[model samples]
Target chain A: MFLKILYHLFVFLALFGSLMVVVSKKAIYSALFLILTMLTIASLFVLMNAQLAAALQVIVYAGAIMVLFLFVIMLLNLGKQAPLSRRSRPVRWLGLLFGVGIGAQIIAVIYSGFIPPAETTAAASVTIDHVARLILTDYLYPFEMISVLLLVAVIGAVVLARRHLVQGVETVTETAEKAGK
Target chain B: MEYMIPGNLVVAVMIFAIGAIGIMWRRDAITIFMCIELMFNAANLGFITLAQSLGKPEGVAVFLFVITIAAAEAAVGLALFIKIFDDRENIEAEKLDLLKR
Candidate 1:
């Protein structure tokens, strides 16, 4: 009973944060809201007995990704922009209507398809060793592929971020370094 | 105990919907990127919840890969934004029209 209450509270917080991210005027605010949402989602993971995932949620999503987001928002100086341009009022209302419709549909799905199953001892099943074994054994090939993908992404980012040297222009970081010297 | 509460999945779906709408509603490119990240987390939450309920550990493994991939995507995406901003002064998504001709 206590766990169920905690779960609902976390879910509410997560959803509220997500809404704030969508509507917030500033990019930094949106990023902060995202962090809040991520943190609450991590709590949800804990409630669901996914300790590893909960840890990763906080470490990866809230820690690493959010830092990158804030770094870019600062680097580009996108903090104070003009207020958002609004779509037509009717269009906005229509979108909201569709959103409510979809939401109702999802509720119906929950009632129909996701009936609660018989309670079991699932909490004792997913030990750390079990997940570790699966990764190193069954999912090893894909794990290796993800590493390769990361390597490629790093190279791609470096190449993309560099200014066109053929144009005889220094990139922002290069110019700043030269100025410091 | 009701093991399959469906609450987590509902939360996941709501978050995902927010991301989908945010991508269209927000003008800033970085904000849109953040929304995409939100969508990724929504999917991750779903995976973790389903794994726990089904007593499967593979979902946790998949969650790790998903996070790593999200990190990679963020790196490449932010770099692209930086490049675009260097070429053009702003990172607003709607204003980029260099290829419109």
Candidate 2:
């Protein structure tokens, strides 16, 4: 009973943090709110017995992706922009309608019993070792393919950054030579 | 099945919704990317929760795949951000009218 209450508390906090991430004005505060949201979600994963996933949530998302976001925000010095005024009334109404439509669908799914209650069947215990075995055996091909995708991404980033650096150096040289002449 | 709905699922939906709203409304590119990451994390949470509920390891397997994709996204997004900042000295998405008609 205590644990379930704790889980609900965490979920509420997570939801609140996510809302803050959306509503906050400052980019840096929004980023921080996102991190809070991630951590709360990770805790929810832990509650669901997804230990490995919780760790991945922290390591990959909170650790890696968020840091990259922070770096970009800081690097760009994105603080000087005028506050983003609200979009047109029609656009705002459209967004709210869209959200309400989706929420209604989710509620319908829950109420219509389209989704079986979580406790209907006894959950079989799955350990990290079992998860690893499945990954190594059943899902090997997809796993290898994902690595290939990562390799491609690395190459793409390098190519893009290289162009920027090359252009910057060329511009510096051109200006220096012009000054000398 | 300890609860009516899995705790993780609720969290996932909440996080995903937050990210979706941010992506739709935020003007800053970096904030948008962060929102994207939140969306990915939300999906990962859902995957893991469903795996646990179903009594399978497929959830973790999916999480691994997701992690790799997230890494790739971060790499590309960072590179793009750097390039944009270098070119315009600003990263506001609204300012990029070079391609817009």
Candidate 3:
């Protein structure tokens, strides 16, 4: 009974936080609310017995990703004029209409009784050991691929950001040489 | 025995829809990025729930991959946004017409 109540609480918090992320005028507020939403979802993962995922969600999504977002927001220093400047009233209304349509369709599908309830007997206890074994054995190739992907992403980000700096430095040196001559 | 879908998945779908709508309704690049992250989180929740219900660890394992990819995407995406802002002085999606040429 307590678990069920907790589930409902987290679900409500997640939904509310996500709505705030969407509607908040300030990008900073949206980032903060996104963190809240992520944390609440992490809690839901715990409730579902996905302890590892819950921990990673907190560490990665709520912790690292949010910090990155905050850093970018500060670096950009987007003034008050930056939020929702491009979206007109009609675009917003149209988006809302489509959003509602899609939401209703999903809810209807859920209520249609097509999906099967979870079998209590099939709820295998997911210990960290079990997950580790599966990762090392059955998912070894994909696991290695993920590391490679991360490496590539790091290189790409650095190269992309640094290109402009390199050009700026070249321009400065060219002007300095011309002045010296 | 009548079977019903788990409520967790329903909530996940709702969050996904909200994120998608936010993407379309907002113009700030950072806000749109945040909405996209929200959608990723919703999908992660769905994966974990399905894993728990179906008695499989593969779902959780796949989630780790998803998280890793999301982190990479966030880094690259933010860097791109920073570059865009530097070049254009604004990160509004509609005003980003440089690619039209």
Candidate 4:
């Protein structure tokens, strides 16, 4: 019973955080809410016996990714702008209708009894060691590919950001020239 | 325990739907990107749940790969957003119509 209550609590928090992320006016607030949502989801992973995933979710998502988001939010300095725009009332209503419709469809599918009942014997729990071994053996190629992808991303980010710096310098020079003239 | 799998699945679906709606409704590029992350997280939840139910480590393995890709996506996407902001002075999605004829 306690576990069930805990599960329900995390679920509530996760859903609530996601809603806040969507509706918050400030980008900083949205980023903070996303961290809350990620942490709740990580706890849910723990309840599901995915401890490694739970840890990574906290470390990579709540830690690294969100920090990046916050950095960009600060870098962009969006506070001076008007509040985030809201869709027109009719569009907002249509979006709500679509969201509800998709949700109802999923709930219907869940209740259709199509999902096989859980096996009587609990499945062997996955451990970090087992996942590591599987990655080294069966999934080695994709693992290597992921490393390459990360390398590419690093280079791409550097190039893009550097280009912006150069452009800023050029614009500053142009304005200075105009002032001199 | 019998209801655990389906319950988790329902939560995942709700999260995905919420993310999808947010993506459609929000104007801020960063917010839209965060919404996309939410959708990815929902999918990751479903993957982990199904993997646990089936007693296989493969799903977790895939989850790791997905997480790696998500990191890369965040890096490149934020860089692109910075570039766009440098050009336009704002990150509003509706105002980014450079490609729209």
Q: What TM-score does model 3 achieve against the real structure?
A: 0.89
DockQ of each: 0.56, 0.55, 0.57, 0.60
Q: Tell me the TM-score that candidate 4 gets on chain A alone.
A: 0.82
Q: Report the lDDT tens digits of candidate 1 across residue range A116-159.
A: 55347545346678889999999999999999999999999998
DockQ-superior candidate, 3 or 4: 4
Top-TM-score structure, candidate number: 4
- Residue-pair clashes per prediction, in order, are 0, 2, 0, 0
**CAPRI rating of model 4:** medium
Task: Write down the TM-score of every candidate.
Answer: 0.87, 0.86, 0.89, 0.90
Q: Where does model 2 sit among the CAPRI classes? A: medium
lDDT of each: 0.82, 0.74, 0.83, 0.86
Ranking by DockQ: 4, 3, 1, 2
Poorest 10 consecutive residues by lDDT, candidate 4 chain A: A164-173
> After superposing candidate 2, which stretches have Cα over 4 Å from the reference?
A80-82, A119-122, A167-181, B4-7
Query: For model 4, how does the per-residue alpha-carbon lDDT over B1-101 read when each residue is reduced to its tens digit?
Result: 55678988999999989998888788889999999999989989988887777778999999998998999999999998888787768888887665452
Superior by lDDT: candidate 3 or candidate 4: 4
lDDT of 2 by residue, A17-77 (tens): 8787777788888889988988887887777767777888888888987888788677667
Instruction: Compute fnat per model.
Output: 0.62, 0.59, 0.73, 0.68
What is candidate 1's TM-score against the reference? 0.87
- lDDT tens digits, residues A1-181, model 3? 7777777888899999999999888888888899999999998887777789999999998999899999989898975745664557888888888888887898788678765667774455566787899999999999999999999999998876664555435433345557769
Q: Alpha carbon lDDT of residue A136, candidate 1? A: 96
Better of 2 and 4 by DockQ: 4
lDDT of 1 at B25: 71
Please, what are the lDDT tens digits per residue for candidate 1 over residues B30-61? 88898899999988988887777777888899
